[model samples]
Target: MTNQATTLPESFRELEPYVADWALPTRQERYDMRLSKTIDELGEFYDAIAPRAEEAIGYLNELDLNDLPDDATRLLHLLYSMVLVSYPVNVFKQPRIPDSGAAFFDTVAEPSV
Candidate 1:
């Protein structure tokens, strides 16, 4: 978990010791972290949407989710927004996420590559 938290270059200072805990995990570990982040987000409303939801049908109206359609590629990001931003953003124009109780962040670095 800590390893996953350090991947952000911006948070390097805060994560430095966390990073040094191990030489570094492999590139595949990096990819897994990204994938896990997507999966972790599913918990936010998974119970409500899992077998399915009316909003899922509505947002996807005239579209087929089960079909290996074009938009299916974005299934995770779309779900992330629906859970993290879209649904709440609709009711109020503000951004409010429960976890982190709020996010405090800093853009500390920019990649040369």
Candidate 2:
């Protein structure tokens, strides 16, 4: 959504390009998305977001978790997605788990932000 880029806080607007695909709301969604993309795509996202992660976390820490602004909530989701992709980018070097054919994780519930 173009609106996501415009709506994100100015400091993180550079990451807006990824919001549409990566700002998912659940663990399962994020995990599935990681598997769907190629390693190169995951690396692209990792390279862009990893450097700013601490800063983003610091920014989020300042806000009230119970009442985060919509932009902040989206940013948090983006961060979660980053976590899901890091494994493939750093270790496996592949989108899906190595040699885990047809196996997937099914989460009954995800922690609320």
Candidate 3:
């Protein structure tokens, strides 16, 4: 167990360093966070999380998405943020949308579960 209160499952403690920055609740927030970081920064997060994604999904698969514990909920958000940043890290090699000036996405309704 970690000395600080655990924000993620014990097995995923290695990801704690990213929780403060990457664990976002809404899709738009995750997207905005992606736009805020440099490609290198996004790549760093991608490299760290990609290898553990399947494991994280497997662990989360056992839980109820609708009523996850606080730790699991945060983990879910981290996954969401990872997805948001992936395009920039893997394809675009840029933070903002390409060839779309002032274009932005506003999430009207976040997923229920």
Candidate 4:
């Protein structure tokens, strides 16, 4: 694999170091970091990136999925995982606001039958 960093959207540049070719963490590594960590504890990472969530999704959506390189494919899967878990569907009626008053919001998923 190339040692060069994968190009990412401006909004995702902060993650460049973490996702660099030689330093990319495995799915298990990412999960291990989150074990027993509260959202409050993890806010530093997400709070900064949450604003760009939509843009990231848009960029991913525009990609030709079938033709992505290994690095790009891995990054795509990582972003999808981030998006899926960050927004709880059935657990809450509305997006929860932090005690610090940051107004992060996401669409509430419809009730499941």
lDDT of each: 0.35, 0.88, 0.85, 0.48
Give one digit per residue, the lDDT tens place, for model 3 in 7-40.
8988999889899889888787778778788899
Instruction: Indicate the worst ten consecutive residues by lDDT in candidate 1.
Output: 15-24
The best-first sequence of candidates by TM-score reads 3, 2, 4, 1
Q: What TM-score would every model get versus the actual structure? A: 0.23, 0.91, 0.91, 0.47
CA displacement after TM-score superposition, residue 87 of candidate 3 (Å): 0.5
Candidate rank order under lDDT: 2, 3, 4, 1
In model 2, which regions exceed 4 Å deviation?
Answer: 1-5
- The TM-score between candidate 3 and the true structure equals 0.91
Quote the lDDT for 88 in model 3. Answer: 82
Q: In lDDT terms, how accurate is model 2?
A: 0.88
Regarding lDDT, does 1 or 2 come out ahead? 2
For all candidates, what are the clash counts? 0, 0, 0, 0
C-alpha positional error of residue 8 in candidate 1 after TM-score superposition, expressed in Å: 29
Report the lDDT tens digits of candidate 1 across residue range 1-113.
44444432322223223232222223233223323443334343343333343544455455554553433323323333334433333443333333545454443553321
Query: After superposition, which runs of candidate 4 have C-alpha atoms over 4 Å from their true positions?
Result: 1-7, 17-26, 36-41, 74-78, 84-113
